[model samples]
Every structure is written in structure tokens, then in C-alpha cells.
Target chain A: MKRELTCIGCPMGCRLTAEFNGTEVTEVTGNGCAVGARYAREELTNPKRMVTALVRVVGMERPLSVKTEAPIEKRLVFDCLAALGAVAVAPPVRIGDVILENVLGTGVNVVATEDIGG
Target chain B: MNMKTKRVDLLIIGGGPAGLAAACAAREAGVTNLLILEREDALGGILRQCIHNGFGLHTFQEELTGPEYAARYIARVQELGIPYECGAMVISLSPERRAVYVSRTEGIVAVEAGAVILAMGCRERPRGALGTPGWRCAGIFTAGTAQKLVNLEGRMPGKRVVILGSGDIGLIMARRMTFSGAKVLACVEIMPYSSGLKRNIVQCLDDYGIPLLFNHTVVDIHGRERLTGVTIAEVDGKKRPIPGTEQEIACDTLLLSVGLIPENELSAMAGVALSPATGGPVVDETLATNVPGIFSCGNVLHVHDLVDFVSAEAARAGEMAARFLSGEKTAGERIPLIAGNGVSALVPEVLSKRPEADVTFMFRPRAVYRNARIAVFRGGKQLAVKRARILAPGEMAEITVKQDAFCESEGELTVSVEEVGA
Candidate 1:
């Protein structure tokens, strides 16, 4: 099987072609750097992304911004967001405070990235 | 009440990536009495609200989130023991580099600095700037404001969304809203070409299966209490809406990511000459404005597509400001830089003869070009030429010219681009 993808590793946005043979990579081409080839390989199998979302905060007009500690599987993004939607925390929250632990068993915890004052 | 006055060798007007990097560079250059003034309760500025990754690729050679990229500089500032004041808003500035600010901790203070760096950054062009026919609505928000609301405040501005511009922020937010389960109907751009990075177009729009409409704009907005929908129409070459091509998109929110304008109110107050092309201060090779002791960099000098470039340029500005405070004169004659054919504008509108080192000139092409040659000319004599595979208005291009390249030239420099075949 042959697939064409744009490498998001950098702003260059090199168009990459990946050939796969029975779940085994055959060849990758048209990448500007080595990172693009690695990105194409991962994208062809078990694609993952870093997730950013919001969590409810009491006594505040808005929710607090949170993100996964690391990139999670691409297919699990929506499920992770759904899991984060049900969470709420009070104000006086500091940056790097964990909101959800081991989200969706991805071993990635969602933590606050901004300080919300009471 | 008694007013307190402070003196510093260098005063940076912002504490974001640009200001923070400038302060660190100035401190490292042996400027001990350097101070940074930030209006927010803490440092980091806008980066605090930008949680998505894709920053620091050039500076750090790794992709870092906005906060993480900022923390690196903030940690450096702390490690250097550089002094910075939070919740300090600079109210007024004079041509003599005197600044008056009011802070919560200190009522009102005056700052006398030998040199100042203008790093106020830029602001998004608001709805009023677009002049779209619309009623006063609640769901209309600038793309940056929406990003802050979603990323910092944890609020969804709307459910069904229609983004009015294809800027990087708008493209990123389209994916952000989609990941959060909001329906992003479409993205509209007035220009035929997208103004965002290609990486964003692929990762944010293509990945989410969102349609990007070119040569289109929102003509009318429908909403009385909240946003109901928006009427979009295709435009002609003049950008005026065409008849009978109107389509109404039922969206609860309309996000505008039109463009960014340099926040130069302070630069103007300080009597710095502004560039008509960039809407920022007109500076020379040393990043020094026409005003002797004042320098400008980062978004306040021009809107940069990458934060990495902002840090690099601001570092040069910091070092120059330090040298100015140390009473060292840059040895060279001033030569004007002209942006000719196919080039939109050039930063450091003037270059110095026999620069201490190779100086890089940054510019943007007026339009898209493939396989073009960017040439620098001095009185019809080509000094340097660089071949570019592709050039777009969204991306900034740069070329470095060695000091020896202009060793014998005493004439003005003209930078232009020409098609390889034509």
C-alpha cells in the first residue's frame, strides 16, 4: 500500500510518500530531513498527538486550560476529551497541577497550564 | 504622596519571549542594572495562553509547547538574577527614554534608562477593522481571544463555528474546537492563498477534514442576541463581494483571525519614525530607531510568523542597546535598503557599511513564486543571489550578506526577486 502525507514536523511541510507492505514499512521519500521520515513511519502506524483541553473551575467565569503530559494515540483523542469534560476543580489552581491521572490508560496525565486566581 | 524614581542601564517594555530574551542577552553582555516591566500578574505574556506545541524548533532544535518555551527563558531570567516588575503598566514614554508607569505594589514610579527596547508585541485586527455588515453580537471573538478563552479560562466560545480567516491562529483553533467536540463548519479567506503556514493547513485543517474557502469573505452577520449564522460571499479581484454568490452558514460563533498590527503607540509617543510598510519602527542594521538610545524588535518591529525569529532578532536588539549604554559607536556609514520588484518590504530599512559581521536581511515576497532568485543589487551590480524553491507572503525569507560583499559599495542596496525562467 502507498500513502501520501504532509510532514508536520516543521514549517517546511514536506510532502512525504510512504509505502507499506503488510504492516511493514517499505520506503519513505520526499522528506526534507530525517525527522520527516520518522514522522511518516509513526503516522502510518499507531499515530499519536498531544491533546489540549479545558476543565471546569468553580468560582471562575471560565474553565482552566489543561494538556496531556505526553502525546497519546490519535484514535483516543476524542475519548480523552470526553473523559476530561466531566472534570471540575476550584480556583487557586497553580500551573502543572494534575487534573486527571492516567487518562484513558494512556499513562498521560492532564495538568493545568495556567494559574487561575480565586 | 511621594513618587519614586528608578534608574536602570536597560529597560525592556515587555516580559514575553521577545522581552525576556532581550533582557537575558543584555544581562549576559554585562549590563547589570537591567529591568523588565510586564503588565500581567506574572511573566510569560501571551505564551501562557498558547498551550499547543510547535515552538522552539530553531532556537532549541526541539518542539516545545508555548508555556514550556517561555519557562526556559523565565528560568534563565531568574537564574541571572535579573530584576523584573509584574503588574506594571507603562503609561507614558518620552523621546529621552524616560518612562512613567503605575504598579499595584508601587503607586507611581518614574524610570530613567540609558536605552530602551520596544518589545510590546502585536495585537489582532478586530471586527471593526474588517467592516463586515453585522449587528452587535456576543459570539464574535478574535481568534487570539478565543484561544485564550479556551486554553486559559476553559470556556467554549461556541459549539458550531465558522472561522473568517485562514491565519495560523484560526487554523489552529479550528482543530482545537473540533477536538473539543465543536463543529467547525468552514474557514474563509479573502485572499486566494492562505495566509497561514502550510504545516498548519495540513495538520489543523486537512487532518480534521475541514474545508477552507478561498477568495471568500463574510458579507453579513445574522444575530440579534447571540450569533445565529453568517452570510459569506465570493469576492472579485478588488475584494468586493460579488452578487448572487452568497451562502449562509449556520454557526453559533464567528472567529476572526484577520491579521496582526504592531502595537506601537509607545513607539509613536517616543517620537520614533514608523515604517509605512510594516507599521513598526524604522530601524537601521543595529535595530536602533532614528532615536539615538531607543531600539525595537520582535512583533513590535514586524509581525513574525515564528517565535524563534523573534527571539533571535530581539537578542540582537538587546546586545546593541547594551553597546549603546556602554558608549561604543558602531563603525560604519548608513546605506538605505530598498524593497524592489516582487518584494513586499525589508526589515532594518537601512544597513551599515562594513558591518562587524554578516548581517541577515529579512523580507516577504509580494506574491507566491516558485523557483525564484532573490538578488541584492548595488547600482545595477548584483552583489548576492539566493535561489528559493518556493516563496509565499505568509513566510518570511532571509538572506545573509557578508561585510566584505559591500566593502567597495557606497551606494543604496536594492533587494528584488525574479522568476528563474522569466
Candidate 2:
């Protein structure tokens, strides 16, 4: 199988073609750098994405924004949002405060992105 | 009726990243009295609702979310003891450097300042600006508004969405809406190329498997009361929709991210001349406007692609205001700047030849040029030239010319791009 896509590794945006055989990427071409080859291999198999979302704050008019400590499985984004939708935190929350420990067992903790005063 | 009045050495409008950075810089520059007025209830401006990361890379050398980036400046403003008022909207500004404002606490207040900095940022071009044939309905919203609704209010805009433009904000929101369980049918752009950054296109749309249809636009908006669907069509070179190319998609919301316009009504009220191309104030190298005591920066001066640039520009504007108030600002000959070719909406329309101040000419390219040379000319004579691998209209390009490269004699300076071997 052949997959064509733009490289997110850098601004150069080298259009890449990845030839894979049953989940094993064989060769990557049209890359300006080594980073593109690695990106194609990782994307063809296991893909991850940084998740940024909002969580409800208990008794507050606005929600608190949060992000995954690291990129999680791409397919787990909506699941993470669903997880965040049900959880609420108390006031005096500071940025970098952990909201969810190991969200959906992805091992990526959801951390707050903003500070909210009580 | 008499209103509460006060005087300050420098008064900054809008307490966003621009105003906050400017106030800190001005205070550090030894400006004794300075104040910032923000119409919003908070100090961060639109950054308050921008929860996604990828900001502050240039300014802090770190990737931070919008609020985190704004917090850095807000903290500096506090430590420096710069005064600011929230919900204080400057209603009018006069050429005399007097400003009238209204706030919930200070019903009416007037301020006179030695100098002023206009930091009011830009606003999104609305549906009315697009001239799209659509009924005034409830389901339509500007992309930023939808972003605010999702990020700040934590409320979804709709279950199914159709975004009209490929601006960065719209691209970001497309991913945001998808995370919230909304099905974004398509991202339609009237132009053949996307104005958003390459990184965003890869992560925001491609990662989610969303289709980005270039050279297409919404021809007809369906469902009168609430948005039920929209008919999109491909456009010709002139951007006119071709007949028989219309395809209808069912969606509950239409998000318009067509473009952004600088909020310069107050600048115009103060009699500041605006550049027709940028829809912002015309200023010199120091970001000082035609009016001696007034300066402009950030989006009010010109729409910037990044907030880090806005903060950097605003910091300089603050320093310029400090120089203006110090009674030490030297009078310099004004050299006019022209966008010669392959460039549009070049900023700092004029150059102020301060002995130590080198200026960078920033502009948008008319089209894509690879392996191009940006040339700076003074009276038909080339003064400086810079090389770039690629330049595109989607990205802002710049060339820095040293102060000594220019002659003492005043000459019309022009900035243009030339494709190598063209």
C-alpha cells in the first residue's frame, strides 16, 4: 500500500510517499530530512496527537482548559473529551495542576492550562 | 456634564498582550505614569479563549497555550506596578491626546496623556462582509466566536458544521469541534491556496481526516430559521462560482473564518491616517503615527500572523512613547516607503532615520516565489538585498536593512521581491 501526505515534522512541508506492507512501512520518499522518514513510519503504524480540551469547574460559570501532558493515541481524542466532560474540579486550580490521572488508561495525564481563582 | 478626569504620561488602549507588554516596556523605560484600559472584563484579551498551544515559540522559546502566554505578560505588568482598568472602554480619542471612556465602576472618565498607544487588536470579518447570499439566522458564527463558545463557555456550537474559510482560527476550530463530537463536513476556501500555516493543515485537518476543498465556496445557505445545510460550489480563477458545480451538504452550523480586520475606529477618530491595504494605522519605524504623540502597534497597526510579533512590536511602541515623553526624541527626516512589486500591505509605511534604529520591512507576497531575493531600493538604487528559499502570500516575509545602509539624503525607499533568474 502507498500513502501520500504532507510532513508535519517541519515548515518545509515535504510531501511524502510511504510504501507499507501489512502495517510495516517499507520505504519513505520525497523527504527533505531524516525527520520525515521517521514521521512516516510512526504515522503508518501508531499515531498520536496532543489533546487540548475544556473541563467543567464545580460551581463556576466557565470551564477550565486542560491538555494532555503528552500526545495520546489519535483515536483516543474523543474519548478523552468524553472523560473530561464528566469530571469537574474545585476552585483555586492553578495551571499544570493534574485534572485526570491516566485518562482512559492512556498513561497521559490531563493537565490544566489556565489558572482560576476561588 | 462634568466627568472624572485625570492625567498620565502614557495611556494605552486595550489591555491584551499588546497593551500589557507595552505598559511593562514603557514603565521599564522610566515612564513615571502609565495606564492601560481594557474593554473586556479580563486582562488577557482574546488569548483568554485560545486554549490550544503552539504560541510563544518566538518570544519565549517554549510552546505555551494562549492563556499561559498571556499570563507571562500579565505577571510582568503586575511586578512592574503598571496600572490598568478592566471593562474600561475608550469611547473616543481626540487628536489633542484626550481620551473619554466608560466603565461599570467609573461611569465616565476622561484622561489626558503625554502620549498614547493604540493596542486594540483585530476583529473577524463577519458574514455581512462576505456578501454571501444567506438569511440572517441563528446557526451562523465567525470561527473565533465558535472557538470562544467551545473553549471558554465549554458549549458546543453545533453537531454538524461547515467552515467557510481556511484561516488558522477556523482550522483550529475544525479540530476542536471534532473533539466535541461534531462532524465537520468540509472546509471550503474561495482561494486556491490556504492562508493558514503548513503545520496547522497537517495536524488540524489531515490528522482528523477532514477534507479541505480549495477553490470552493458556499454558493447558497440553506434553511432559513436555523442552519440545516449549505450548497457549496467550485470557483473559477476570478472566484466566481461556476454553475452546475453546486453540491449540498447537511450541517447545522456555518463557521466563517474568511479574514480579520484591524480594529481601528478609535485610531481614525484620533485623526490617524490609515493604510488602505492594511486597514490599519500608518506609522514610521518607531511605530509612531503621523500624529506626533500617538503610536500604534499590534493588530491595530497591521494584522500579524503571530502574537509573538505583536508583543515584540508593542514593546517597541511602548519604548517609543517613552522617548516621546522624555523630551529627548530627536526630530528626524521622514522617508516614505513604497511596496514596489510582488509585495502587498507592507508595514511601517514611512521610515524615521534615527541614527541607531535599523528597521525591518515586513509585507505579504503577491504570490508564491521560490529562491527569491528581497531588494530594498533608495531612489531607484538598490541599498540592501536578502535571500529566501520561498515566500508566499500565506506567510509574512521581511528584510532588515541596516541604518547605515541608507544615505543621509531623504529618498523614496522601495521594497520589492525578485525571483532569482526570473
The number of the candidate with the highest DockQ is 2
**TM-score for each of the candidates:** 0.91, 0.96
DockQ of each: 0.42, 0.63
Clashes of each: 2, 0
**Which CAPRI quality tier does the interface of model 1 achieve?**
acceptable
Which window of ten consecutive residues has the lowest lDDT sum in model 2 chain B? B403-412
Regions more than 4 Å wrong, model 1: A1-42, A56-65, A87-102, A107-118, B330-333
Clashes of 1: 2
Task: Give every collision pair in model 2.
Answer: none
Encode model 2's per-residue lDDT on B1-422: one tens digit a residue.
68899899999999988898899899999997999999999899889988998889999998888998998999899898889999999999999999999999989999999999999999999999888887887899999999998888878889999999999999999988987889988999999888898888888888778899999999999887898899999999999999999999999999999999999999999999999988999888888888879999898888888999999999999998999999966457777788989989899888766545678988999987877999998877777899886788878899888887774535778999989963
Chain A TM-scores, per candidate, are: 0.89, 0.91
Alpha-carbon deviation at B116 in model 1, angstroms: 0.4
Q: How much lDDT does candidate 2 score?
A: 0.89
Candidate with best TM-score = 2
Residue pair clashes in candidate 1 = A63-B153, A63-B154
